[model samples]
Target: MKEVILALITGFIVGLVFAGFKLPIPAPPAFAGVAGIIGIYLGFKVMAWAGPMFAEFFK
Candidate 1:
């Protein structure tokens, strides 16, 4: 769905920002990938929780 796609995109963008800023600590490429994975999982969970609103808006 659109909301899932949007959440994934946003998560990727956030991961990029986190990678750039060195949040928590400086991380290598592998760590950044881990952060991206975490971001994606969290994003999807959040989108699922917000599904009703997104379904109404995006549909």
Candidate 2:
């Protein structure tokens, strides 16, 4: 998607800037940390998808 591409590009640029300045990258440095972030995103998306169904059921 266009948004995905844009995000990748932006991240790449920021990474380059950080590397150029010899600064630490502003993100998780390990796979487990990255997986945690993915898990959080998935949790949020799953809740968003299920919320309406639950609301309808309750009503």
Candidate 3:
């Protein structure tokens, strides 16, 4: 929870700084981009879950 709050605050500050400079916010501007991020996260989770199983197989 603390990390999440920190990320939110950091993102908010970056968004403001970008806007102040009249630049685009460095965030996904479309649903597709958001979905791609989600997919990457899910893939990482799956790999972590499978890691121990694969390790045992080789031993």
lDDT of each: 0.80, 0.95, 0.91
lDDT of 3 at 1: 100
lDDT of 2 by residue, 1-59 (tens): 99999999999999999999999999998999999999999998998999887886766
Across residues 12-47, which tens digit of lDDT does each residue of candidate 3 receive? 999999999999869898999989999999998987
Number of the predicted model whose lDDT against the real structure is largest? 2
Q: Write the per-residue lDDT of candidate 1 for residues 1-59, one digit (tens) a residue.
A: 99999978987888888879877533345777889988999999999999887797877
Clashing pairs in 1: none
Candidate 3: give the clashing pairs: none
Residue 58 C-alpha lDDT in model 3? 57
Top-TM-score structure, candidate number: 2
lDDT of 3: 0.91
Which structure is stronger by TM-score: 1 or 2? 2
User: In model 2, what are the clashing residue pairs, if there are any?
Assistant: none
